[model samples]
Target: MTDDTPQTRRPLRVLAAMSGGVDSAVAAARAAEAGHDVTGVHLALSANPQSFRTGARGCCTIEDSRDARRAADVIGIPFYVWDLAERFREDVVEDFVAEYEAGRTPNPCLRCNEKIKFAALLDKALALGFDAVCTGHYAQVILREDGTRELHRASDMAKDQSYVLGVLDERQLAHAMFPLGDTVTTKEEIRAEAERRGLAVAKKPDSHDICFIADGDTQGFLSKRLGRAEGDIVDESGTKVGTHEGAFGFTIGQRKGLRIGTPAADGKPRYVLDISPVTNTVTVGPAAALDVDALTAVKPRWCGTAPSGPGTYTAQLRAHGEETEVSAELVDGALEVTFTTPVRGVAPGQAVVLYQGTRVVGSATIASTRRAVAAV
Candidate 1:
């Protein structure tokens, strides 16, 4: 009779998401350098692989897949391409159109991170027997003493991407790896690293625009996607100022391109205050109307443990933006936040990420906002 005990390996298997950019290429190299058995995966999110435009900013094209594969080769790791165009369209593109039609601005990158990279993609990796999935996001995932995972801002605060990723739950964080978190690597540094390694994506410009909107035709895309519904552009007093092609064309707090020449009595710049999809009207007002103090966010997703009572945290309404000190309360699964200083133009449907110092506590979708009923 013999007794045997098997030992697990120190280095783990990781799947790094490569987007044909220097950041992602460096991420794969860092993963390999960290002693992990890394494999690069590029998500193909366009039906016409050749139609994937890279001159401007976009992702998930055949060319991008090839660049990612080349980077993987340079890093001495295996590579594969996964066709996720259908899922991306359904989860991100359709949702963006729907939200615009509803007169609410949507953050498609946040949706992509939540549904695609961390959810669907993570599931696929787990099924393939990978211990973790890595990305080039400038954010950190810290494991707490109680075995719960927490998200944090990256070392490069200016490049930190924690806002869009705050919606991730603990389960996703447990299997997620952000290779570029601890380093203060600028965009140039990543590219230089890629060039030093002779990676194909060394000089690949980062994707700046939404992947689906290759021509940067947001208005045209919305018109085609949501169907043109004629609307009236009105002033603060509900007086019709001009006509709009559709309600989906405007968003809250937009300042320019109203095309209304009518001069106001006060000679102040008119900004977008509200948009009504039902009446198909875009309401314009003075810039004063954009200021908001309190905001309500629905579907709050806590990072580790859900807040049980009223607490103070820094709240950021926009991604890659500044955080304002605020008091947050967990009320019936929603977060009611009162900014310490008035935050202007906080729009609905934007993500509100709460943080305690450098650690991301939770996040929610902004459902409503107004002047603070009470001071914080």
Candidate 2:
């Protein structure tokens, strides 16, 4: 007799990380429909969890866990909440503070994806015998004939999130599933499906800019965590133009909040061009000073096999920034991304995600930028 019992037959087990949002809800539902034994897991990240999410944007609050449970219930899958507060603090929160204090702008969401979500959660799911960890990320993983999974941008280019998820390596990609990849063409479509399935968070607004900073005051938040270190606001000639409360509060390319009394000799408004953490100095310059000719990056991460050497690729600096054609050459142990056309707002400690067309092939953390020597 053929063995067809639930206890005897092997089933595909997937752990879906639900964030109490419509995307994750629909993603979990889709996973269940795909014949996988799916379990919904909501990660409790905030140390001081709010009883309810403020307004419609805030997330990871107590309300999210309840919403995730309801979605799991509707999908007829098991649901559980995991407390990753300590890990999130160490990996994501502290890292954000440290990066800013070190004179580099950091992306906490990307760090969460790199350290907490994929690394921590994926590790835990694997130990529990789950085949893969599924998320609602707007990126696709295509399993090729060569038995390698390729990470590609979603059909909806506007909503493509491959940039933030650039840290995933080959091992992680092999066991990662993005249910909302190419299937859900738009956010509205995901919401409509959630509503059709009776999921309550269908009409929920997207999460806020920074979830941890509930009040949306990043400077105040950083100032509190990392104590204020008053510094000098200087110009290109090293002349002190003004004074600042804290050096950590400013970022490169920042034009506002400099609090300078007078404009430069050129009569043009100044933009933050450099931040010296050691000297606690914030340097402001004209708008053209922000342009970068090349960027040197470290901690390189290749999606699949590491490329041999120097080659031409699409270099995407910021998350929503335009992809500029560039030539990437590996020198010593770093990746040097040279642009034929100067790029703007190229900050250190930011991710420089490389793309071979729509595929996210590799990534690196920008260590430093080389600007034009001549005046603009």
Candidate 3:
């Protein structure tokens, strides 16, 4: 005779990062409804333990944490707040200031995704014995036939956030869940769902990307952080035309706030060409100089398990920007993207995300940008 005992499959436990927003609230509820043991967690990024920004509708504030807690309670799940201020300051805030000082535009949200969300929080969840980590990011992941994960654009193209998440590698993709990915739910639908559930923040406004920089005073933030350092703004021919508060205040391809009066020799509006931190000068030139067809990026990270062979792809230089068809040639530790048509306003120190169809193949930090000297 043989004795038979029942075997039990453990329930899937998901740790959802709730920012007290409608999207995340709905995401957690959906996960719970799908039979997963869901727990909502909010990250506190404030420097001071009790200090939270005013009208902070996003994550990391007391009000947001309360909202998250209330949503979790309404869903009959547990919730907690994790203090990650030190990590945020070091990884996101410092990197932002340093990149601007070096005359390079920085994507702080991308940095936060790489350093805080997917890296730190993910590790913590794994260590705490959670089966998976979930976020409200508008991106999707697909498992291919070869058992490899692929990152793809969200079905809602207008709300796609694949650009910020392009830096994720195979490992992170394996253990992450984006509940808002498969559905093409607009922001209005999400708010309606939250309201139907009687959850707060249903009508709350969306939060800004750089929440710490109040009033969107990037120049003021840099001035206060790095101290005042004056510089001269010059033209293409190296003629001094105007003065600027700081070199970090301006970025490549900027045409406004140049403070230049005289028209160019061709009588055209002057644009920013180069920012020289060494000489402390902001170079201005005609708009034509900003056109670029070629760009190179370093430390490339691919989302798929494909070989780094040469192939044609589309690339986006900025978040939410149009994707331009391009031919990609992978070199030793770098990717050189050449546009089919002359693409303009390519800047250094931004990310170049390559895509094959809707799937993100890889991404890299822009090393340099240049216009095609010869037509293809």
Q: Give the top-scoring candidate (lDDT).
A: 2
lDDT-sorted candidate list, best first: 2, 1, 3
lDDT of 3 by residue, 245-360 (tens): 89999998898888887778888888888998899999998777778888888878878664556789988889989999999877877888888888777777899998988999
lDDT of 1 by residue, 135-199 (tens): 98999887654656778899899799999899898888878888888788788887888888888
**How do these models rank on TM-score, best leading?**
2, 1, 3
Where is model 2 more than 4 Å wrong at Cα?
Answer: 1-11, 51-53, 374-376
- Residue 31: error of model 1 in Å? 0.4
TM-score of 1: 0.94
* TM-scores for candidates 1 onward, in order: 0.94, 0.95, 0.93
lDDT (10s digit) by residue, model 2, range 117-149: 899999999999998788888898777656676
Steric clash pairs (candidate 2): none
The C-alpha lDDT values of all candidates are 0.83, 0.85, 0.82
lDDT, candidate 3, at 209? 47
Task: Give the winner by TM-score: 2 or 3.
Answer: 2
